[model samples]
Target chain A: MINSISKVINDVGLHARPAAEFVKLASGFQASIKVRNLTSASAWVDAKSIISILMLGVSKDHEVELMADGLDEELAITTLRNLIESNFK
Target chain B: MHYTLVDLLKSEHIMMAVQAADAKAAIELLTAALVESGYAEPEFSVDVWKRELAFPTGLPTQPVAIAIPHADPDHVNNSAVCIGVLATPVEFGQMGTDGSIKLLVNIVFLLAIKEREKQVAMIQQLITLIQSPALLAGLISAKDKNQVLDLIQQTLNEEHK
Candidate 1:
């Protein structure tokens, strides 16, 4: 298992379009991915679920922890961390 | 300026027991209300519809399914939430899917956000409201727009904590 933490810098945070983008990318990986909003102290939720991501209510400057388990966990963590660091660009 | 969910919702924007053929019709029905109320421009409908086609917003919540359709800020004159309670459920492509997953949505929340900063918080408020099956049930069973508005206000009021 691999875990990493990152900050959401986008103005809209992880809702709407950004949530969709995050879930879509997370769904492509075979590893089981989970994310929790550290800033909000939200419970860990499936990274591929849109509703779960939306429920996190992660706003700008909020820190989130992403965890991946199974094969390709490293790649998944790297890709998703890059996506967040790039502000979902 | 920061706006709460109650501040963005109005009785005029709430349509109860609406009947629509499909997702587009449901969106158009709510979009028409927002456009007519001068909260959103005419092009707002087109932009929102296009975005819906690409990234559907239907969420399969318990007790009832709902959809939150929104567009870019460019066509919005004011930030408002237009709601429609469909008398009969309509099929909407599930969000975070490859257009294959579908959900029969009974209610639609058309969010017209003029400010980028408020979008995430506004949606979070809605998400908080919908997570409550009791509130969602009230929204589904409420007979009139006033009742819907009241329920939403009640839910949002609790959001302050």
Candidate 2:
């Protein structure tokens, strides 16, 4: 299954702490999740990797697409989308 | 596998004065340069930037400023290093704490490694280099890539011995 959601980076940027937090959150679910820039047609990267997310150069106003495939795909997508939408607040 | 900093850095890794206005531009330019040097795949740079944004790599120093650009091993297509010297200092999120950093960051060590374990020695060597005030000054003041490479080699060699 495939689901897509877009959100602007609300925080200053995803820097280390936020990145680590995002990874920790993503790692909890067994489903495979990948995030990518909506403007860039690159393969989705492992959502749980801090390094992978940082390389995307996502800044404020940059839109990202999160994709997931697995048994709990819906829950994973919704949760991640909410996380991004709320800017991890 | 054993690799020297010289082996990790290629001709393309050497960029003079990057004309980026902000962090995003800086990251894009640096990543493209790494790809050109064959140090990493084209996609690898973007991966690194994305990861960096998520987890800022700026490490605060006592006498000078430095940042180590590293990303998940899965995003790396090869084992290599890229260096960047910004024309103007940019804000890098503080390492190990919640703060903002705006130092004249003259050095950026972009590491693209295939295996996380293999990076231990290199990381140790880098930590040593950072702790040395004299060496750090020499690195920041080095005029060219040759000088930078030589300094790195000397420092690493000294650490090994």
Query: Which candidate wins on lDDT?
Result: 1
Clashing pairs in 1: none
State the RMSD for candidate 2: 11.9
What are the per-residue Cα lDDT tens digits for candidate 1 across B43-113? 99998898788667888898999998887677999999888999999998886564578999998988887
| Superposed Cα deviation of residue A78, candidate 1 (Å) | 12
Residues A13-56 of candidate 1 have per-residue lDDT tens digits of 88877887887788789998989999988667678655568877
List the RMSD of every prediction in angstroms: 7.6, 11.9
lDDT of model 1 at position A13? 89
Model 1, which residues run further than 4 Å from truth?
Answer: A1-89, B159-161
lDDT of 2 at B46: 73
Query: Where is the poorest 10-residue window by lDDT in model 1 chain B?
Result: B115-124
**Cα lDDT tens digits for candidate 2, B66-114:** 6776676655667777777666666665443233444445566677777
